[model samples]
Target chain A: MIIEGRTWLFGDKIDTDVLAPGYAMKLSPEGLAQHCLEAVDPDFAKLVKPGDIVVAGANFGLGSSREQAAISLATLGVGAVLAKSFARIFYRNAINIGLPVVAIDLTQEVAPGDILKLDLAAGTLTRLKDGYHRELQPMPPHIIDILEAGGLMAQLKQKRGL
Target chain B: MPQTLTQKIIARACGRTTVKPGEIVTVNVDLLMGQDASGPRRWRPRLEELNAKLWDPSKVVVVSDHYVPAVDAQSAEILNISRRFARDYGVKNFFDMQGISHAIMPERGLLRPGMFVAGGDSHTPTAGAFGCYAAGFGATDTTAIAITGETWTTVPETIKVQIDGALGPEITAKDVMLWLCREMGMENSFKSVEFMGSTVSAMSMSERLVMSNMAAELGAEAGIIGVDEITIEALKATGGDYEGAEAWVADPDAHYYKTVTLDVTKLGPQVAAPHAPENTDDVGAFAAVKVDQCYIGACVGAKLEDLQMAASVLRGHRVSPDTRLLVAPATVRVTEQAAADGTLATLTAAGAILLPSGCGACAGMGAGIIAEGEVCLSTTNRNFQGRMGHKDASVYLASPYTVAASAVTGHITDPRELRTSTRNAA
Candidate 1:
């Protein structure tokens, strides 16, 4: 699996409350994307375009089990979230929602708005601007299998012969 | 091979005799719960995709806890839809207006030792107090359970926490947890934490809930306490069958990567400073920090016992003129019992505003919204930026006792200083 997108850099432990505030708890998924990251970066929802990517320090997507944190990002058409590490549930939530999450060191390799190409099989990330490439942590077989089946729903449906 | 309680539960659910960390397996979920906001709204679409056949309705539960009194038309409609869906799907295990299911589920005997329960809400790991492996996931995973009654996981490594020494008369579980977060920095956010040693064995069932409820706040997958007398008593309280609960304890040689010890006797009332649960200091460390809101609720801090502790401190006193203190019981049932026991009356008399039972302000849903630049002292778990509504509003987390004492002074006052008026916790 390979994914390509422009980059958005964030700091460590960028929690869900900043990603999806409680005021939007009643809003639709699309409405949630509009307010996603509005707490930390007020222009996030309005500025994010589809196929953009999030790059962050360790412990990204921390706090809360709200799927909208991942939903809003995916809804805004984020290609992937490449972080040094991730919170347990947020990582699963992202994959279950069909959002690709890659563990990589994109901090020093690329700057804001730099395009990135991630190749899962080769375990490499290429910076289109500078052609600087780096190896990333490989996705385990189980995660890849689930992703291949198109998230949890598709996997369950396929397993159940639906 | 020896295994931790969480590992054993996962292995058993996977129908394997043994498993190790980093190995993946799909296991049938023991229980799955959701609320008005997270339940059917997301599941409806996935259910339609799966042709609407529920794998096992008995294992699934829908409850109306969020927006319980129907704050708006949308909330009211969501609650109605939850009831209708439970009826249409024959899911008999449903709750309405029960407050936080994180506390209600165990109190009602739905969670037990050795079970692997998944909830749509993030705080569901509170069930881990029963020696079960419980974690929170999104509604998409909850819907997957509806289809195949199973979810997948990579076994997480275990970290052992050895708590020793007797707690001070005024110190409580809340203090110990905040101290742990501060000292440990929430290590192993994707790992399991197993509590061992004398203090854990001596804690009451209610006390254990205080620990387990905050495990998620530490970013851990689950926190397990060895099943013992308190565990058995918890099971007996709800008339739950606990014939095999004793076996939930980890084997003698279970694998543990690290050990963090806490000497309760040496610890004092601690508070998590604003912006993060892991940011902590001695209660007196922030004596100059005044507060605008004082909250005692949420799954972690609002158990009946917690309410009793706060009421004991506020029995004949009033909150300071500048401070606003709020006491929210964890559930409707707790409300009735507290009222009968005078806990409610005491808090109300002390000018502690009693809010309805539900999870609101802890997640910034608005039962107690803070003004910009306002500071709050609370017993609720987590104090992230914007957690209590205003991003500029700060939150300080401490025990109900500390919060109650602070309510009277309108600043971060230590509970020990008011010893003449406060009752002994033990």
Candidate 2:
């Protein structure tokens, strides 16, 4: 599977509080998405287009186990996230919700709004702007299966014949 | 084969004699915990959609700490849904407004050593103080575990954190953790951190809980300390099973991805400035920073021992007229115990306003939250931006001792200075 999107840049330790602020947690998914990353980038939710890719520095989504942090981004139509690293729970949370998360340091190479293409099966990401390419370790088959089945909930529904 | 304590517990859960790191395996969960925000309020809809019932309600524990005494209609509805979920599912261990789930689980003897536990909140590793292989998961993963009674894990390589020597007076586990946040950094993902050494062994259950609790801040899968006499005795006192609990210790030759050691004899009280837990410095460095609020609350910092630490510092002193102090015990039991021991009296006499037993103000919810441009010195963990209130509010993380001392001075004062001055006067 291949994904293409414009890049949106963020910095190191972009914690869960920024991704889904605690004060806005009581809002609905759509409402919460409007406040996503509002602490750092007030225009993020409004300006972010569907199929946009978030490229961030290390330890992205570093605090809190709130799945809403990932949910807000997915709700805003973010196609995938590429960070230098991620907090373990957030990584799994994103995958469980059918959001693709990749680990690669592209903060220096890619500018905001630069279109990028991700080949999930091939484990390759190509910078459409400069034709620069980087390889990432392919996800395990079981994880891929879960992603293909549209996340863990969907996979579970399939197993139960729902 | 030698195995880390984490591996031993996971192997038991998976019905295997041994397991290796990096291998994915399905393990039966001994207990599953969740609180209002991440628990039933989110699970109910998905469970209904899947037409599923809880695999075993007896193994599930739910708490209403997050939205307790709901401040708004939305929060009230969330709490109501949590209550109805427990009733409909026949979840016997449901704890409504009983304080944080991390403190409630052990207080009720629901956790046992060697158990494979999953919680729906990040601080769930607090149970690792009892030697359980406890880790936090997202709502969806927790929902899956609720339905299946099992979950998959990619076994994590263990990072051994060894701290030797005694903590100086006024220095507590919170100080050690703040220092570790800087030493280890918050990027050790996909790893389990086991804290051990004379320092951890000598720590009370409350202090040990702090060490394991902050392992989340270190970005570890779980923060654990091997079961010892203190653990066994605490379990026995709490009416939990302690039989063979001491066998949960890690083998001496167990493989570790890395071992980080610290000698705490010379360590001073540490504090982390706002925006990140890893941004730590000695308490003295922040001495001139005045605070608007001094809060001692949350699952990690509002236990009986933590309350006692604050009370000791505030025994004959009053909170600064310039700064307000809020004290929220971790649970009803902690409050009862503190009240019985005069700890509550000492705190209140110091002009400390008592808050309800819940995750108040710590999760940027409920009461006592700061406003824009306000600053707070907090005993709770995690001072991430917008965590405890307005985005512009600055928070500094410190031990209860430091928080109480700072409350008296209206600035980030080291507890040692106050203790020394008090002793000199006495």
Candidate 3:
């Protein structure tokens, strides 16, 4: 699978609270998406375009097991998330919800608005601006299968003939 | 092959004799728990869309705690949906407006040894105190578990934490967890944390639950403790079956990815400052920070024992005029127990306002939330930015004893110092 998008840089420990703030939890998924990253950068939801990629330092999506954190990003059409590391639940939540997330260190090399391309199957990332490339650890086959099916629910639906 | 308790539990659930770390396996879930915010309120629509029903209603437990007592129209609607989901699904173990799901699960004898559990909330590892492999999952994963009675997990390596020596007066499990959060950074993802040693063995099930609950703050997949006589006794007290509980112990030569050892003899009451649970230090380090509110609530705090800790410090003293004290028991049973034992009386006599039993204020929902620029010393687990209220508000984490002591002084104060000073004055 290939994904291309402009990059949005974030720092370490970008927790679920900022990604989907508690105050906006009661809103619809789209309304909640409007408040995504509102605490850190108030303009994130308004400024973010479809197919934009989010790159962050270690422990992205660190707190809360709310799937809305991942849904908010997906709702805003985030192409993929690349971080140095991720909290276990958030990583699973993102994948289960059909949001592609990768654990790779591109925070230091990638800057905001840098267009990048990701070949998930090949486990490689490329900065379109300068042709800078980095190898990424490939996801497991089962996880890839789920993502290809557009999430666990979709995969389950397909398997059950529902 | 020798296996850690976590591996043993997973092996049993997956019907495997052995499993290795980093291997993905789909394990049958023994029990599934969900709260108002993450469980039914979110799962209802997804389940409808999938045209699916619960795999087994008896194995599921639902609780309405997050938006209980109808704070507003939206919250009231959320609670209503949770109720409808429980009834529509034929879930017999539904707990309505009962308290936090973590504390309520054990109180009702739902958790048992060697069980593989999944909970909707992040603090689900609190069940790990019962010698189970209970880990938190997001709504989508939980929904999948609800439909199939199984979910996949990447087997996690175990990180053993051994604590020795007895806890001194006023230094409770909350302090130890705050200390652990700093000592072991909150970046330990994809790992299970197991607590062992003389100290853990001597602790009550309540204290052990606190240790496992905060494993989320440590960023661990699950926090577990080996089952012992204390665990058996607690299980019995709660009317839970404990047959074959002794078999859940880890092998003597089980391998651990890492081992951390701590001696509680010299450890002081610890505190984590604003913004992060990992930003911790000795209680004295935060002495100069005056607090506008001292809150005791959440699954990690406000248990019966936690309430007793606060009552012990507030028995004869009063909350400072400058600071307001709020105590929201974790569950209704905790409230009843505290009231029956005079713990609630002691707290209220000291000017502590009691809120309804729920995850109030701790999750930045419900009552007692602080305003911008105000400071609160809380007994809850996480204190991340804007978790308890305004983004500019500062929330500090500490034990119930320290929170109660600070409530009395209007500043961050050590519980031991207040105890000594009270004796000195007497």
Candidate 4:
């Protein structure tokens, strides 16, 4: 999928509490989508458009591995996540739920609210306004296979010819 | 290539002889877990989205202790979701508000040595207490574990923390951890830490469990207390069939990326300052700091010993009118035992409000919230900015002794002074 959005840049260790506050933990996935980043920036939910990408530094999704962090971002219409590194659980959860996560070398060249374009299949990232190009390590064949199958359950179903 | 704990565990799970750092490999999971707050939301949706029939329902465990008995409608809703999810999935291992997920998992034999356990909560690394290469992952990772029972991970290098010397009075495992948090700060990111040496050997499993459980807050993948007789006894208490459980230890010549020594004798009661668990200072340095509230609960503080400590200081005393004291047990069983022992009576008579066994104030889900400019001395983890209540409110982290003393005095007072007060009363 070709995705484009204004990048929401965050520094290292953006834990689950910031992504999905404990107070709102009771809300449905759709409800959580509306409150994403309410702790860090109140207007983040309203400001984000569909197909937008969130770029964060190392240890993104660092604290509690609640998949809600990924599901909330996904249901909020986050097109992709680009980070320097991801906590193991968050990374797996994002991909399993059909959210594309790319680990790219973060540089000072990108700033918050910078419009960027990502081609998941091509493994290419481009800052739309600045014309900056950065290539990311693409998902391997097996991971892409899992994604195309729409997660592990679907992959199993397909393998069984169901 | 040097083998790390992550490498060794992943390799065995993947059926490989060896794996290197930064190399990705998808390995099978021996156990999967989720707590009340995160499980229902993530697992139910993923289960539906995938449309897969539940595998062995017993392999999955749902715990509802974060806000058991429901703190508010939100917490209540989450609890309902967890119960409904567990029932529908036929999950026989649902721990309904029984206790902290980590504390209960071992008690139920869900954690095994040399097994790969994944949980949706950060403290899942608590399984490492039993030599399981357990670690916490985000919800998405849990979805994978729930569905495929496997995940890809990069191996981490090991860091050895050697402990020696006996603890002095008032020194406890909690003090050892807070000291590490101060010494390591956030610089401890993404490493495996193992506790070894004579001092570690002398510690009880409960004490070691406390140390390993908080390792996540330090940014480490997992913390391990080397297996010993104490571990065997703990396993036995939990009905663990130790028929084939192998004992493993770090080799005398094993490699570590870093080595830090902790002399428990030198450590004192530590307090995490406002906004950061890592911003810890010795209690004597900040004894005069006042508080508006005092809370002792969460997995860290609800231990029976913790309550006894609080009760000893609070007996025949009253709480400060300005300072509210809330004590939540970690489990219903804990509440029952304390009530039977009259610890509950002493605490309630001292004006300490007894909340149910749930996460409560630790996660700021229910009572004990402070107003703007108010400060609270708490026995929970993470004093992160605005974590306890209003962003402007301050939270000071301390042990039950400090929290109880502060509750009675309306200001933070050392437990040593409480002893003096008791002497005067006699």
* DockQ of the two-chain complex in candidate 3: 0.80
Report lDDT (Cα) of residue A73, candidate 1. Answer: 93
> Residue A38 of candidate 4: its Cα lDDT?
73
Whole-model lDDT per candidate: 0.85, 0.93, 0.93, 0.76
Q: Give the per-residue lDDT digits (tens) of candidate 1, residues A46-159.
A: 887777889998788778888888898998888899998898888998998788998775677678889988887788888887888888787888778778887877777787
Sequence-dependent TM-score of model 3: 0.99
The clash count for each model shown is 1, 0, 0, 9
Candidate 4 chain B worst ten-residue window by lDDT: B242-251
* TM-score winner between candidates 1 and 3: 3
DockQ of each: 0.71, 0.88, 0.80, 0.39
Residues B1-426, candidate 1: write the lDDT tens digits. 988888899999999978899788899898999887788777886798778667889888887777766778888888888888888888888888887888789878887788998889878878888998988888888887777788888888888999999998779989999988887785357788888888888888888888888888788989888788889888999877699889999998888877888788889899999798899999889999989989998888998999998988887778999999987788888999999998899999999898988886887874887879999999988988887888888999999999999999899888878765445532
- Model 4, span B226-265: residue lDDT tens: 5677777777877875654554445466567888887777
What's chain A's TM-score in each predicted model?
A: 0.95, 0.97, 0.98, 0.90
Better of 3 and 4 by DockQ: 3
- What TM-score does prediction 2 earn? 0.99
Model 1 per-residue lDDT at B253: 86
Docking class of 3: high
Clashing pairs in 2: none
DockQ of 1: 0.71
Q: Write down the TM-score of every candidate.
A: 0.97, 0.99, 0.99, 0.88
Sort by DockQ, best first: what order? 2, 3, 1, 4
Native-to-model Cα distance after best TM-score fit, residue B134 in candidate 2, in Å: 0.5
- Give stretches of model 2 more than 4 Å off: none
